[model samples]
Target: MNHTLLRLIIPGVFLTLATGCVTSTVDEMVFDEPSEGIGDATVVILGRRHASDYETEPDFIECVGKHIAARDKSIEVIGELEFLNALYPWFEPRTAPLKPSDIDKLMLQRPVAQKLTALKTEYLIWIDGSTVRNDSAGSMACGIGPGGGGCFGFGTWSNDADYEATIWDFTDRAEVGRVNTKATGQSYMPAVVIPIPIIAPVQGTACDGIGEQLLQFLSGHY
Candidate 1:
Protein backbone atom coordinates (compact mmCIF):
# COMPACT_ATOMS: atom_id res chain seq x y z
CA MET A 1 0.00 0.00 0.00
CA ASN A 2 2.94 2.32 0.70
CA HIS A 3 4.91 4.00 -2.15
CA THR A 4 8.01 1.85 -1.46
CA LEU A 5 5.96 -1.39 -1.55
CA LEU A 6 4.22 -0.24 -4.73
CA ARG A 7 7.58 0.36 -6.44
CA LEU A 8 8.83 -3.15 -5.58
CA ILE A 9 5.64 -4.92 -6.53
CA ILE A 10 5.27 -3.08 -9.83
CA PRO A 11 8.75 -4.13 -11.04
CA GLY A 12 8.19 -7.70 -9.99
CA VAL A 13 4.88 -7.82 -11.82
CA PHE A 14 6.47 -6.59 -15.03
CA LEU A 15 9.26 -9.15 -14.76
CA THR A 16 6.74 -11.97 -14.44
CA LEU A 17 5.29 -11.05 -17.83
CA ALA A 18 8.72 -11.06 -19.45
CA THR A 19 10.74 -14.13 -20.37
CA GLY A 20 14.22 -14.62 -18.99
CA CYS A 21 17.25 -13.85 -21.15
CA VAL A 22 18.74 -16.51 -23.41
CA THR A 23 21.82 -16.62 -25.67
CA SER A 24 22.55 -19.36 -28.20
CA THR A 25 25.21 -20.21 -30.77
CA VAL A 26 25.43 -22.91 -33.41
CA ASP A 27 28.55 -24.14 -35.24
CA GLU A 28 28.78 -26.75 -37.94
CA MET A 29 31.48 -28.51 -39.93
CA VAL A 30 31.07 -30.56 -43.07
CA PHE A 31 33.76 -33.15 -43.64
CA ASP A 32 32.42 -34.74 -46.78
CA GLU A 33 30.52 -33.33 -49.72
CA PRO A 34 26.89 -33.07 -48.63
CA SER A 35 24.27 -34.50 -50.90
CA GLU A 36 22.28 -31.96 -52.88
CA GLY A 37 19.00 -33.58 -52.00
CA ILE A 38 17.54 -36.37 -49.89
CA GLY A 39 14.79 -37.44 -52.30
CA ASP A 40 12.69 -40.12 -50.53
CA ALA A 41 15.31 -41.27 -47.99
CA THR A 42 14.67 -40.88 -44.28
CA VAL A 43 16.72 -39.18 -41.54
CA VAL A 44 16.80 -40.61 -38.02
CA ILE A 45 17.64 -38.53 -34.97
CA LEU A 46 18.73 -40.35 -31.81
CA GLY A 47 19.88 -39.17 -28.42
CA ARG A 48 23.11 -40.46 -26.88
CA ARG A 49 22.71 -42.03 -23.43
CA HIS A 50 26.09 -43.55 -22.76
CA ALA A 51 27.24 -40.85 -20.36
CA SER A 52 27.31 -41.79 -16.70
CA ASP A 53 26.52 -38.33 -15.42
CA TYR A 54 23.51 -37.51 -17.60
CA GLU A 55 21.58 -38.72 -20.59
CA THR A 56 20.53 -36.52 -23.50
CA GLU A 57 16.85 -35.87 -23.11
CA PRO A 58 14.60 -37.80 -25.48
CA ASP A 59 12.20 -34.87 -25.79
CA PHE A 60 15.02 -32.63 -26.94
CA ILE A 61 15.88 -35.06 -29.70
CA GLU A 62 12.26 -35.22 -30.77
CA CYS A 63 12.04 -31.44 -30.67
CA VAL A 64 14.93 -31.02 -33.08
CA GLY A 65 13.54 -33.68 -35.42
CA LYS A 66 10.16 -32.04 -35.47
CA HIS A 67 11.66 -28.65 -36.04
CA ILE A 68 13.48 -29.92 -39.10
CA ALA A 69 10.52 -31.83 -40.50
CA ALA A 70 8.18 -28.93 -39.97
CA ARG A 71 10.41 -26.39 -41.67
CA ASP A 72 11.22 -28.55 -44.68
CA LYS A 73 8.50 -30.77 -46.03
CA SER A 74 10.97 -32.56 -48.25
CA ILE A 75 12.86 -34.01 -45.30
CA GLU A 76 11.46 -37.12 -43.68
CA VAL A 77 12.34 -37.74 -40.04
CA ILE A 78 12.05 -41.01 -38.16
CA GLY A 79 11.40 -40.78 -34.41
CA GLU A 80 14.18 -41.80 -32.05
CA LEU A 81 12.19 -44.46 -30.21
CA GLU A 82 10.82 -45.95 -33.41
CA PHE A 83 14.26 -46.21 -34.96
CA LEU A 84 15.84 -47.61 -31.81
CA ASN A 85 13.13 -50.18 -31.34
CA ALA A 86 13.33 -51.16 -34.96
CA LEU A 87 17.07 -51.69 -34.76
CA TYR A 88 16.89 -53.41 -31.37
CA PRO A 89 20.17 -54.51 -29.74
CA TRP A 90 22.29 -53.20 -32.56
CA PHE A 91 21.65 -49.58 -31.64
CA GLU A 92 21.34 -50.13 -27.93
CA PRO A 93 23.56 -48.16 -25.59
CA ARG A 94 25.81 -51.07 -24.76
CA THR A 95 26.27 -52.25 -28.34
CA ALA A 96 25.66 -49.15 -30.43
CA PRO A 97 28.41 -47.89 -32.70
CA LEU A 98 30.64 -45.42 -30.92
CA LYS A 99 31.89 -43.67 -34.04
CA PRO A 100 31.01 -43.30 -37.69
CA SER A 101 33.60 -45.90 -38.66
CA ASP A 102 31.95 -48.36 -36.31
CA ILE A 103 28.85 -48.29 -38.46
CA ASP A 104 30.85 -50.12 -41.09
CA LYS A 105 31.21 -53.09 -38.79
CA LEU A 106 27.49 -53.13 -38.02
CA MET A 107 26.66 -53.19 -41.70
CA LEU A 108 28.65 -56.38 -41.99
CA GLN A 109 25.79 -58.08 -40.20
CA ARG A 110 23.21 -59.01 -42.82
CA PRO A 111 20.24 -58.25 -40.60
CA VAL A 112 21.48 -54.76 -39.73
CA ALA A 113 21.93 -53.91 -43.39
CA GLN A 114 18.52 -55.32 -44.27
CA LYS A 115 16.71 -53.27 -41.65
CA LEU A 116 18.43 -50.06 -42.71
CA THR A 117 17.67 -50.77 -46.30
CA ALA A 118 14.03 -51.44 -45.50
CA LEU A 119 13.75 -48.10 -43.69
CA LYS A 120 15.46 -46.24 -46.54
CA THR A 121 17.52 -44.48 -43.90
CA GLU A 122 20.07 -42.13 -45.42
CA TYR A 123 21.26 -39.95 -42.57
CA LEU A 124 21.71 -40.94 -38.91
CA ILE A 125 22.15 -38.05 -36.48
CA TRP A 126 23.40 -38.82 -32.97
CA ILE A 127 22.81 -36.01 -30.50
CA ASP A 128 24.66 -35.86 -27.19
CA GLY A 129 24.50 -33.47 -24.26
CA SER A 130 22.14 -32.01 -21.67
CA THR A 131 20.77 -28.87 -20.12
CA VAL A 132 21.67 -28.34 -16.45
CA ARG A 133 20.90 -25.74 -13.85
CA ASN A 134 24.27 -24.28 -13.07
CA ASP A 135 23.80 -21.65 -10.38
CA SER A 136 20.94 -20.40 -8.21
CA ALA A 137 20.40 -17.81 -5.51
CA GLY A 138 17.70 -16.10 -3.45
CA SER A 139 14.77 -17.40 -1.39
CA MET A 140 11.07 -17.00 -0.63
CA ALA A 141 9.02 -16.97 2.57
CA CYS A 142 5.34 -17.51 3.23
CA GLY A 143 3.11 -17.17 6.27
CA ILE A 144 -0.54 -17.51 7.19
CA GLY A 145 -2.33 -15.11 9.49
CA PRO A 146 -5.89 -14.04 10.21
CA GLY A 147 -5.37 -11.13 7.80
CA GLY A 148 -4.28 -13.36 4.93
CA GLY A 149 -1.71 -15.82 3.62
CA GLY A 150 0.93 -14.75 1.15
CA CYS A 151 4.50 -15.32 -0.08
CA PHE A 152 7.31 -12.84 -0.66
CA GLY A 153 10.93 -12.84 -1.77
CA PHE A 154 12.91 -13.22 -4.99
CA GLY A 155 14.98 -15.96 -6.66
CA THR A 156 16.95 -16.53 -9.84
CA TRP A 157 18.86 -19.37 -11.50
CA SER A 158 21.02 -19.98 -14.53
CA ASN A 159 20.81 -22.82 -17.03
CA ASP A 160 23.24 -24.00 -19.70
CA ALA A 161 22.54 -26.36 -22.57
CA ASP A 162 25.32 -27.84 -24.69
CA TYR A 163 24.74 -30.41 -27.38
CA GLU A 164 26.45 -31.84 -30.43
CA ALA A 165 25.03 -33.72 -33.38
CA THR A 166 27.10 -36.20 -35.36
CA ILE A 167 25.79 -36.81 -38.84
CA TRP A 168 26.50 -40.12 -40.54
CA ASP A 169 25.75 -40.82 -44.16
CA PHE A 170 24.44 -44.36 -44.23
CA THR A 171 24.52 -44.36 -48.00
CA ASP A 172 28.24 -43.60 -48.09
CA ARG A 173 28.99 -45.40 -44.82
CA ALA A 174 30.83 -42.33 -43.54
CA GLU A 175 30.46 -39.39 -41.25
CA VAL A 176 29.38 -36.28 -43.10
CA GLY A 177 29.53 -33.54 -40.52
CA ARG A 178 29.06 -32.36 -36.94
CA VAL A 179 26.90 -29.62 -35.52
CA ASN A 180 27.34 -28.12 -32.05
CA THR A 181 25.01 -25.81 -30.19
CA LYS A 182 25.23 -24.07 -26.85
CA ALA A 183 22.69 -21.97 -25.03
CA THR A 184 22.63 -20.19 -21.68
CA GLY A 185 19.85 -18.36 -19.89
CA GLN A 186 18.65 -17.12 -16.56
CA SER A 187 15.25 -17.75 -14.94
CA TYR A 188 13.71 -15.59 -12.27
CA MET A 189 11.04 -15.90 -9.64
CA PRO A 190 9.84 -12.61 -8.21
CA ALA A 191 7.34 -12.76 -5.40
CA VAL A 192 5.41 -9.95 -3.82
CA VAL A 193 2.17 -11.46 -2.59
CA ILE A 194 2.51 -14.36 -5.03
CA PRO A 195 5.34 -16.02 -6.90
CA ILE A 196 5.61 -15.37 -10.61
CA PRO A 197 8.17 -17.40 -12.53
CA ILE A 198 9.99 -16.13 -15.64
CA ILE A 199 11.58 -19.17 -17.23
CA ALA A 200 14.29 -19.17 -19.90
CA PRO A 201 14.01 -21.64 -22.76
CA VAL A 202 17.67 -22.66 -22.73
CA GLN A 203 17.25 -26.15 -24.11
CA GLY A 204 14.65 -25.04 -26.60
CA THR A 205 17.00 -22.44 -27.99
CA ALA A 206 19.73 -25.03 -28.37
CA CYS A 207 17.31 -27.32 -30.20
CA ASP A 208 16.29 -24.62 -32.63
CA GLY A 209 19.88 -23.67 -33.34
CA ILE A 210 21.00 -27.21 -34.03
CA GLY A 211 17.88 -28.05 -36.00
CA GLU A 212 18.39 -25.12 -38.33
CA GLN A 213 22.03 -25.93 -38.78
CA LEU A 214 21.27 -29.57 -39.53
CA LEU A 215 18.60 -28.59 -41.99
CA GLN A 216 21.05 -26.44 -43.91
CA PHE A 217 23.78 -29.04 -43.65
CA LEU A 218 21.61 -31.77 -45.06
CA SER A 219 20.32 -29.52 -47.78
CA GLY A 220 23.93 -28.96 -48.94
CA HIS A 221 23.60 -25.25 -48.27
CA TYR A 222 25.93 -25.22 -45.25
Candidate 2:
Protein backbone atom coordinates (compact mmCIF):
# COMPACT_ATOMS: atom_id res chain seq x y z
CA MET A 1 0.00 0.00 0.00
CA ASN A 2 1.09 3.55 -0.62
CA HIS A 3 1.99 5.74 2.41
CA THR A 4 -1.09 7.94 2.00
CA LEU A 5 -3.51 4.99 1.80
CA LEU A 6 -1.84 3.23 4.72
CA ARG A 7 -2.09 6.37 6.88
CA LEU A 8 -5.78 6.81 6.13
CA ILE A 9 -6.60 3.16 6.81
CA ILE A 10 -4.68 3.16 10.11
CA PRO A 11 -6.59 6.19 11.42
CA GLY A 12 -9.90 4.69 10.41
CA VAL A 13 -9.08 1.40 12.11
CA PHE A 14 -8.04 3.18 15.30
CA LEU A 15 -11.20 5.21 15.36
CA THR A 16 -13.36 2.15 14.87
CA LEU A 17 -11.72 0.14 17.67
CA ALA A 18 -11.02 2.92 20.17
CA THR A 19 -13.64 1.96 22.69
CA GLY A 20 -15.17 -1.21 24.11
CA CYS A 21 -18.74 -2.00 25.07
CA VAL A 22 -19.90 -1.67 28.67
CA THR A 23 -23.18 -2.69 30.30
CA SER A 24 -24.30 -1.43 33.70
CA THR A 25 -27.30 -1.83 35.99
CA VAL A 26 -28.29 -0.15 39.25
CA ASP A 27 -30.98 -0.99 41.85
CA GLU A 28 -32.13 0.77 45.00
CA MET A 29 -34.12 -0.51 48.00
CA VAL A 30 -35.44 1.68 50.75
CA PHE A 31 -36.08 0.24 54.20
CA ASP A 32 -36.89 3.13 56.52
CA GLU A 33 -37.67 5.69 53.87
CA PRO A 34 -35.68 8.87 53.29
CA SER A 35 -36.39 12.09 55.11
CA GLU A 36 -38.61 14.70 53.49
CA GLY A 37 -35.62 16.93 52.88
CA ILE A 38 -31.85 16.73 53.28
CA GLY A 39 -31.67 20.30 54.44
CA ASP A 40 -28.19 21.07 55.92
CA ALA A 41 -27.42 17.47 56.84
CA THR A 42 -24.09 16.14 55.65
CA VAL A 43 -23.56 12.89 53.74
CA VAL A 44 -20.40 10.85 53.94
CA ILE A 45 -19.29 8.06 51.62
CA LEU A 46 -16.97 5.51 53.15
CA GLY A 47 -15.34 2.44 51.65
CA ARG A 48 -15.44 -0.90 53.45
CA ARG A 49 -12.00 -2.43 53.87
CA HIS A 50 -12.69 -4.97 56.56
CA ALA A 51 -12.99 -7.81 54.12
CA SER A 52 -10.05 -10.17 53.98
CA ASP A 53 -9.91 -10.64 50.25
CA TYR A 54 -10.83 -7.26 48.77
CA GLU A 55 -11.28 -3.72 49.94
CA THR A 56 -13.35 -1.12 48.11
CA GLU A 57 -11.32 1.38 46.12
CA PRO A 58 -11.07 4.84 47.64
CA ASP A 59 -11.13 6.51 44.23
CA PHE A 60 -14.40 4.77 43.43
CA ILE A 61 -15.92 6.06 46.67
CA GLU A 62 -14.71 9.58 45.87
CA CYS A 63 -16.09 9.34 42.37
CA VAL A 64 -19.54 8.38 43.66
CA GLY A 65 -19.46 11.19 46.17
CA LYS A 66 -18.50 13.70 43.53
CA HIS A 67 -21.20 12.43 41.22
CA ILE A 68 -23.86 12.82 43.89
CA ALA A 69 -22.70 16.30 44.84
CA ALA A 70 -22.46 17.45 41.23
CA ARG A 71 -25.90 16.18 40.27
CA ASP A 72 -27.54 17.80 43.30
CA LYS A 73 -26.12 21.10 44.44
CA SER A 74 -28.32 21.12 47.53
CA ILE A 75 -26.82 17.85 48.84
CA GLU A 76 -23.53 18.02 50.70
CA VAL A 77 -20.91 15.27 50.53
CA ILE A 78 -18.03 15.11 52.95
CA GLY A 79 -14.72 13.74 51.69
CA GLU A 80 -13.87 10.25 52.93
CA LEU A 81 -10.48 11.17 54.25
CA GLU A 82 -11.77 14.37 55.80
CA PHE A 83 -14.52 12.52 57.61
CA LEU A 84 -12.20 9.77 58.79
CA ASN A 85 -9.64 12.30 59.92
CA ALA A 86 -12.17 14.37 61.76
CA LEU A 87 -13.27 11.32 63.71
CA TYR A 88 -9.67 10.09 64.09
CA PRO A 89 -9.10 6.69 65.71
CA TRP A 90 -12.78 5.92 65.89
CA PHE A 91 -13.03 5.59 62.15
CA GLU A 92 -9.78 3.81 61.66
CA PRO A 93 -9.75 0.39 60.01
CA ARG A 94 -9.69 -1.42 63.32
CA THR A 95 -12.47 0.59 64.93
CA ALA A 96 -14.75 1.57 62.07
CA PRO A 97 -18.19 -0.01 62.12
CA LEU A 98 -18.30 -3.10 59.96
CA LYS A 99 -22.10 -3.19 59.76
CA PRO A 100 -25.01 -0.89 60.44
CA SER A 101 -25.63 -2.65 63.76
CA ASP A 102 -22.08 -1.88 64.78
CA ILE A 103 -22.87 1.80 64.49
CA ASP A 104 -25.18 1.44 67.44
CA LYS A 105 -22.32 0.27 69.59
CA LEU A 106 -19.95 2.92 68.32
CA MET A 107 -22.45 5.69 68.90
CA LEU A 108 -22.84 4.63 72.51
CA GLN A 109 -19.57 6.40 73.25
CA ARG A 110 -20.27 9.99 74.20
CA PRO A 111 -17.18 11.34 72.42
CA VAL A 112 -18.03 9.62 69.15
CA ALA A 113 -21.60 10.82 69.29
CA GLN A 114 -20.47 14.36 70.05
CA LYS A 115 -18.02 14.34 67.16
CA LEU A 116 -20.63 13.00 64.74
CA THR A 117 -23.04 15.68 65.88
CA ALA A 118 -20.35 18.31 65.43
CA LEU A 119 -19.81 17.19 61.85
CA LYS A 120 -23.56 17.25 61.22
CA THR A 121 -23.25 13.79 59.80
CA GLU A 122 -26.78 12.73 58.96
CA TYR A 123 -26.25 9.89 56.54
CA LEU A 124 -23.44 7.37 56.29
CA ILE A 125 -23.05 5.48 53.04
CA TRP A 126 -20.73 2.49 53.10
CA ILE A 127 -19.63 1.17 49.70
CA ASP A 128 -18.20 -2.29 49.35
CA GLY A 129 -16.97 -4.27 46.34
CA SER A 130 -14.31 -4.25 43.64
CA THR A 131 -13.72 -4.51 39.93
CA VAL A 132 -12.02 -7.74 38.95
CA ARG A 133 -10.78 -9.21 35.73
CA ASN A 134 -13.01 -12.21 35.06
CA ASP A 135 -11.42 -13.78 32.04
CA SER A 136 -8.58 -13.13 29.58
CA ALA A 137 -7.63 -14.67 26.28
CA GLY A 138 -5.13 -14.21 23.45
CA SER A 139 -1.63 -12.78 23.58
CA MET A 140 0.77 -10.51 21.70
CA ALA A 141 4.39 -11.00 20.85
CA CYS A 142 6.94 -8.30 20.21
CA GLY A 143 10.61 -8.53 19.36
CA ILE A 144 13.49 -6.40 18.04
CA GLY A 145 15.94 -7.41 15.35
CA PRO A 146 18.90 -5.73 13.66
CA GLY A 147 16.57 -4.32 11.04
CA GLY A 148 13.37 -3.41 12.90
CA GLY A 149 10.79 -4.56 15.45
CA GLY A 150 7.04 -4.86 15.68
CA CYS A 151 4.31 -6.52 17.73
CA PHE A 152 1.68 -8.92 16.38
CA GLY A 153 -1.38 -10.74 17.67
CA PHE A 154 -4.56 -9.81 19.58
CA GLY A 155 -5.75 -9.93 23.20
CA THR A 156 -9.05 -9.54 24.97
CA TRP A 157 -10.30 -9.62 28.56
CA SER A 158 -13.47 -9.12 30.51
CA ASN A 159 -13.94 -7.18 33.75
CA ASP A 160 -16.83 -7.24 36.19
CA ALA A 161 -17.54 -4.60 38.79
CA ASP A 162 -19.96 -5.36 41.62
CA TYR A 163 -20.62 -2.82 44.31
CA GLU A 164 -23.20 -2.26 47.05
CA ALA A 165 -23.85 0.97 48.91
CA THR A 166 -25.61 0.71 52.27
CA ILE A 167 -27.09 3.94 53.51
CA TRP A 168 -27.58 4.55 57.22
CA ASP A 169 -29.55 7.29 58.88
CA PHE A 170 -27.26 8.58 61.62
CA THR A 171 -29.91 10.74 63.25
CA ASP A 172 -32.40 7.89 63.50
CA ARG A 173 -29.66 5.26 63.95
CA ALA A 174 -31.20 2.89 61.42
CA GLU A 175 -30.50 1.40 58.05
CA VAL A 176 -32.35 3.54 55.56
CA GLY A 177 -31.62 1.95 52.19
CA ARG A 178 -29.21 0.27 49.85
CA VAL A 179 -27.97 0.79 46.32
CA ASN A 180 -26.38 -1.93 44.24
CA THR A 181 -24.54 -1.56 40.95
CA LYS A 182 -23.02 -4.04 38.57
CA ALA A 183 -21.06 -3.37 35.39
CA THR A 184 -19.43 -5.76 32.99
CA GLY A 185 -17.44 -5.19 29.82
CA GLN A 186 -14.81 -6.62 27.58
CA SER A 187 -11.53 -4.94 26.57
CA TYR A 188 -9.46 -5.57 23.47
CA MET A 189 -5.82 -5.01 22.64
CA PRO A 190 -4.87 -5.45 19.00
CA ALA A 191 -1.29 -5.24 17.95
CA VAL A 192 -0.12 -4.38 14.47
CA VAL A 193 3.13 -2.49 14.83
CA ILE A 194 2.03 -1.50 18.32
CA PRO A 195 -0.71 -2.40 20.74
CA ILE A 196 -3.93 -0.40 20.65
CA PRO A 197 -6.05 -0.71 23.75
CA ILE A 198 -9.84 -0.46 23.70
CA ILE A 199 -10.71 -0.33 27.38
CA ALA A 200 -14.17 -0.66 28.91
CA PRO A 201 -15.03 1.68 31.74
CA VAL A 202 -16.57 -0.93 34.02
CA GLN A 203 -15.77 0.68 37.36
CA GLY A 204 -16.63 4.12 36.07
CA THR A 205 -20.00 2.89 34.87
CA ALA A 206 -20.70 1.35 38.26
CA CYS A 207 -19.71 4.55 40.03
CA ASP A 208 -21.99 6.70 37.92
CA GLY A 209 -24.90 4.30 38.24
CA ILE A 210 -24.70 4.05 42.01
CA GLY A 211 -24.09 7.76 42.45
CA GLU A 212 -27.23 8.73 40.58
CA GLN A 213 -29.34 6.21 42.45
CA LEU A 214 -27.96 7.36 45.78
CA LEU A 215 -28.81 10.95 44.90
CA GLN A 216 -32.41 10.05 44.19
CA PHE A 217 -32.69 7.91 47.30
CA LEU A 218 -31.31 10.61 49.54
CA SER A 219 -33.34 13.36 47.93
CA GLY A 220 -36.52 11.31 48.47
CA HIS A 221 -37.24 11.51 44.78
CA TYR A 222 -37.47 7.73 44.50
TM-score of each: 0.88, 0.87
Residue 128 shift from truth in candidate 2, angstroms = 0.8
Top-TM-score structure, candidate number: 1
Candidate 1, residues 1-222, lDDT tens digits: the string is 699999999898876567898999888898874568677889999999999999999999999999998888888899999999999989999998888788889989999899999999999999999999978999999898999999999999999999999999887778889999999999998999988889998998999999998888766434
What is the per-residue lDDT of model 2 for residues 1-222, given as tens digits with 9 covering 90 to 100?
A: 699999999999877668789999888898876567578889999998888998899999999999988878888999999999888888887998876778789888899889898888899999999999978999899999999999999999999999999998887777889989999999999999988889998999999999988888877544
RMSD of each: 5.8, 4.5
Please list the residue runs of candidate 1 whose C-alpha ends up more than 4 Å from where it truly belongs after superposition. Answer: 1-17, 33-35, 144-148, 220-222
The CA lDDT of each predicted structure is: 0.90, 0.89
User: Using lDDT as the measure, which candidate wins?
Assistant: 1
